[model samples]
Target: DTAVSQTPKYLVTQMGNDKSIKCEQNLGHDTMYWYKQDSKKFLKIMFSYNNKELIINETVPNRFSPKSPDKAHLNLHINSLELGDSAVYFCASSQDGKDYNIQYFGAGTRLSVL
Candidate 1:
């Protein structure tokens, strides 16, 4: 079984559309995160959830929202998607409040906006 999984491994949409990606993990982790990898291959954290409580990165725009229905799931929603939103999104899970915990990443969802 996959430790982390993301649905709709590919997403193609026009600007101003709304899209969502779902993720789930079975590793019994308490924290889950959403990361965006730009074309330049820079990966940055968009949002994080610990036990269903949200902790968003300040640099992330409000257009991105992360919802964690439970400790093992984290979903990302993008409203009014822009061309700049076209990137690979990754879902990850790790133990909560651990500085050295290793995060397991799911296969990324590639989003293309035109």
Candidate 2:
């Protein structure tokens, strides 16, 4: 079974349109996170939730939102998508408050805005 899976491994669309990416983990972890990796391969944390409660909301734009229905699922919704929003979105997870641990990542959903 897949540990983590995200829909539309690749997404292509135009600017100002709205889109969403869904993520799920089967590892039964208590925490999940969304991260964006730019073309330069720099990763930045966007949002994180532990046990369905929001714990971290980074400097991401208002156009982007994250929803966690449960401890195992976290979805990202983007509105008025912009060219800058075109990047690799990765869903990751780790044991809550366990720093020094590696976060399991999905293959990634690449969003391309034209």
Candidate 3:
């Protein structure tokens, strides 16, 4: 079984549309995160959720939201998506209170906005 899984592996949409990506992890981790990879392949964290609490990254725009319905799931929602929002979104999970710094990542959802 996949440790982390994301739905809609590929998404192509026009500008000004709204979309959501769902994520789930079976690792029983306490910490979950959402990451975005730009066209240049620069990956950056957009949000982190620990035990169902939200922790947004300062640089992430308000349009981008992370929602955790439970410890095993984290979802990403984007409103009025723009061209710049086109990127690969990754969901990750790790054990909380650990110094291991290791996170398991999902296959990623590639969103393309035209």
Candidate 4:
């Protein structure tokens, strides 16, 4: 079983289009998060949910939305995609630092705007 998984490892699409990335974790953690990594490899948290409730919403654009159907799954949807939005999106989960935990990351979804 995978600790965290994301589909469509690479995606190439035209600008102004919409796309979605799916993620799931099996670590039985209550907190899940989404992060964006730019070409510079700077990882920043976008959104975080704990126990199905949103606990953190970073300065992410409105076009980017995160949905968690359950504590084990968090999906990201981006509308009107722009070239600037093309980056590697990662899904992560942690134990909320309760046990000095570190965030576990997925393989990441690479979105490329054409």
How does each model score on TM-score? 0.94, 0.95, 0.95, 0.96
Expressed as tens digits, the lDDT of each residue in 1-114 for candidate 1 is: 999999989999999999999999998998888988999999998888989998656488889888888898899999999998999999999987675768899999999999
RMSD of each: 1.3, 1.2, 1.1, 1.0
Best by TM-score: 4
Model 1 bad stretches (over 4 Å): 97-99
Looking at model 3, report the run of 10 residues with the lowest lDDT sum: 53-62
Q: Rate the local accuracy (lDDT) of all candidates.
A: 0.91, 0.93, 0.92, 0.94
Deviation in Å, model 1, residue 11 alpha carbon? 0.2
Which segments of model 3 are wrong by more than 4 Å?
A: none
Which 10 consecutive positions of candidate 2 have the poorest summed lDDT? 93-102
Q: Which residue pairs collide, candidate 4?
A: none
Show model 2 residue runs off by greater than 4 Å.
97-99
lDDT of 4 by residue, 1-114 (tens): 889999879999999999999999999999999999999999999999998899999998999989999999999999999999989999999987587758999999999999
**Residue 92 CA error for candidate 3 (Å)?**
0.5
In angstroms, give how far residue 44 of model 3 lies from its true place: 0.3
